[model samples]
Target chain A: MKKSINKIVMIGAGNLGTNLATAIHKSGYQIVQVFSRTSESARKLAKKTNALYTSSLDEIYPYADLYILALPDDAVLGFLKSKKLNNFFMVHTSGSLPVSVFKPFSNKFGVFYPLQTFSKNKILNFTDIPVCIEGNDKRTESDLMKIAKNISRNVMVLSSEKRKQAHLAAVFACNFTNHMYTIADEILSRKNISFDLIRPLIQETSEKVKLMKPALAQTGPALRKDKQILSAHMKMLAKDENYKKIYSFVSKSILSKTK
Target chain B: MKKSINKIVMIGAGNLGTNLATAIHKSGYQIVQVFSRTSESARKLAKKTNALYTSSLDEIYPYADLYILALPDDAVLGFLKSKKLNNFFMVHTSGSLPVSVFKPFSNKFGVFYPLQTFSKNKILNFTDIPVCIEGNDKRTESDLMKIAKNISRNVMVLSSEKRKQAHLAAVFACNFTNHMYTIADEILSRKNISFDLIRPLIQETSEKVKLMKPALAQTGPALRKDKQILSAHMKMLAKDENYKKIYSFVSKSILSKTK
Candidate 1:
């Protein structure tokens, strides 16, 4: 039987970090410490999780078995490189940052990437969230898996290279797709149309992908080769050069994929 | 009290048309007739709805109180322009096609655009879906509203111009967003990562926007202004110029919006 992850120390009380801390606490793990660049963030999360808070990195207590570097991907490496591991297992919850980031610091290096787009206000259901994990060794991997399984149901022991690829995919799936929503919102705002009108379709589009392959499920004027409607839409979008450019580019891309 | 819409005749059984027929049927409205250029499509929809189907445009039975032209935007104008009105209330379920398309056909001309992306296999909930309607006059508008309210809980009486803008927004929200999903799926496939991992994030990202403005809810390396991770992702995507361009474009776009 695997042992439970009793205590966890989260570094970086930003959106992902704060949410993860709360989720961990809710999952019955005790958050031993919360650290952030700002005192307010550290204190806020500490209050919520009943964990010790500190703005200073050196003041971090090594009471916990695991340390999660939930800072920005760039900051994660330097933060890891700056500190000596003190023989405790450390993992960075970053998609873009590599597992090798903690190589020089400790042999017990790993990644615990929660593949989800999170916000401070929105509570996420970690049950369905995919936890992509990696470790330098088998023991470290097993330890991280036990921790991950506690918080999330879906856990995958992926290699560092595979994690990198998954992160890149996340950029497209989460970041780029959100950008598309912003564009849609902007277009609606400009026309005095309510953004709420498109909300159902946006939700449905995401839901459909859960059951079907995106390629097989793709639909639009572009895929239909409706030159007339495309031309009319282009004419309608004549004033907005950027949107017109995007329409042409995406239409061409979808057509290429369909072909 | 509004009379129930029992008879619905659908013109142009393409993607939108076929789906609308299915939706109307599922919503307890009787699809009396289905017309299409292709015999196969008309037959398929007719079989699904248990309605009379015809390939010849002239053979369209005027059995329904409501005629829905789920046709291509341009085809709508040409089709309606040639037809003589027989006092039947007609509406084109189009976002781009102007209400003027129905001017020559009937004074009861209006629009019943169920603002959504519909595929044959994917079942949609009409209750939450917005039905953007417009009419040539007040009586027709009221009649159209009655029809819309019968199928959907959320119905809005939008002007022709507003519907056009909504269409543009739909392109951004539905069509373009789906394209982004396609891009994400492609990126993940190329990297040998299952697209399933990012599904939760994609769903959450949209769900977040329902309660919060997309600009405020957006969370990504791009919005965080993390240059290091951004550059790292760029480096990884160096070989794929298309993805690289998209990353840079969307990152810049999102940052601009938040700023």
Candidate 2:
């Protein structure tokens, strides 16, 4: 078996791209080139990975075995349209965009979506992270799997439509859930309570769902039909009509589910 | 200092009561007696803890040093009204009720609130759990702290009103957050998508808030003002008014905060 994929090129040196480059480099892959709209970001990542950095896509090294477009979803298609090339294997690390966007560029196209929210400073463990991969062909699929497996222990092949559904779910699970936490923070701050008070409960709620289906694991005043507590909470959130609506809507949903 | 509080007499065997008794027993404390309204539940927990069980409050052993009242908020006052006790340090593990609830029964009254959600099968780590304690006097505070420190590393003496506020925050952080997960589960299930797909993202959202304030850590299409994606999600949830309202309200709240 081949030990690893050696030559790689990365576009967009933002959070996801930088983290992916760092992980790939740490796994002993040679990052051949780095391209970003910003020279500073590209140069910083290049210096860390010992890769050649260029602001221009025209200066990109063409010989790299795998090229990754880690730009935003809207920007990815534009970047692909401008760069006219590639019989080589290429993939985008996006959860929402369709895989067929690469159809115009290369036959050896796929997706390498690491299903986790990435931020600039947060260092994530890729070992257990689900890397959803899909390829245009069998050989490309095999190659993507091999590379994905090298960087992560969990990898699965999912169709583009399924990946799109997963992205929608990710929005609810990660992004929307974080918004709920922010709501809690705001509510607590207004009442002069520390956010630390809710940290353990948040951790346990997540941990519980891992053991049971989230629906079965669900518990609260809503599920228990504790109208007193529910009304009290609603009154507390009265100033924020948006939060009040969420509180009532979710409570009713939970009540319906339990019934 | 005594290495452990050996003889524990639990005064209520409801959800919190049974769970806390089991946790304390598992942590090597001897649960000497289980007291509750229902003999069946008391016997069930007593059998698990190898302790004597009784439904009659008068049958409770007078020798136990630590008495935990884990009954419902409304029931605590009634339980105290019925029980005549003296010379024993009593702690009610509740976030909402005041320490004065136990003042009529024992001068050594304190609150020993385990700041996490509890269920029958879900075993929790007491070491990392924050125990919010409040005492009527210094000796009671010291006794409660000693007991709390035995089970958990993090313990704080918060006022009863502050603890009430913390409980209110918990409604948002734990209860309402889990409700969001339920909504997400329902959304995916309706789409014929597996909830497992969003598990990683759900876990990451909670984990992220541990390191950064949820307000600073917020991210979503809402924060970016990506009306296209937001509209797409809303359309998908259009048939379900509950979900549509939730999506719009939460998105607007997040966007307002970002601005």
Identify the candidate with maximal DockQ: 1
lDDT of each residue in B1-259, candidate 1, tens digit only: 6464578898878777887788789878889988888999899999988999999867888667788888876677777765633567788888877788666556677889999888866656688889988889888788878767877899999888888878877877777788788887887888677878888888887788876767677778888888877888889888876667667777767767666
lDDT of 1 by residue, A1-259 (tens): 6454588898999888888899889888889999888999999989989999999878888767788888887787678666644567788888877787676778677888898887766657688899988889898888888878988999999887888778777887778777778888887888777778888888888888888888876877888787877888899889866667677778877787777
Q: By DockQ thresholds, what CAPRI class is model 1?
A: medium
For model 2, the DockQ equals 0.54
What docking class should model 2 receive? medium
The true-versus-predicted C-alpha distance at residue A24 of model 2, in Å, is: 2.6
Where model 2 places Cα greater than 4 Å from the true spot, the runs are A1-6, A81-89, A104-106, A188-194, B1-9, B23-32, B56-67, B77-91, B100-108, B184-198
Evaluate candidate 2 by giving its C-alpha RMSD to the native, one decimal: 3.9
Per-residue lDDT for A167-255 in model 2, tens only? 77777777777877877787678777778878888999899888677777776677768676677777767787888887887778778
TM-scores for all candidates: the values are 0.92, 0.86
Q: Per-residue lDDT for B28-57 in model 2, tens only?
A: 889999998899989988997899999987
After TM-score superposition, the amount by which residue A167's alpha carbon in candidate 1 deviates from its true location, in angstroms, is: 1.0
True contacts kept of 1: 0.75
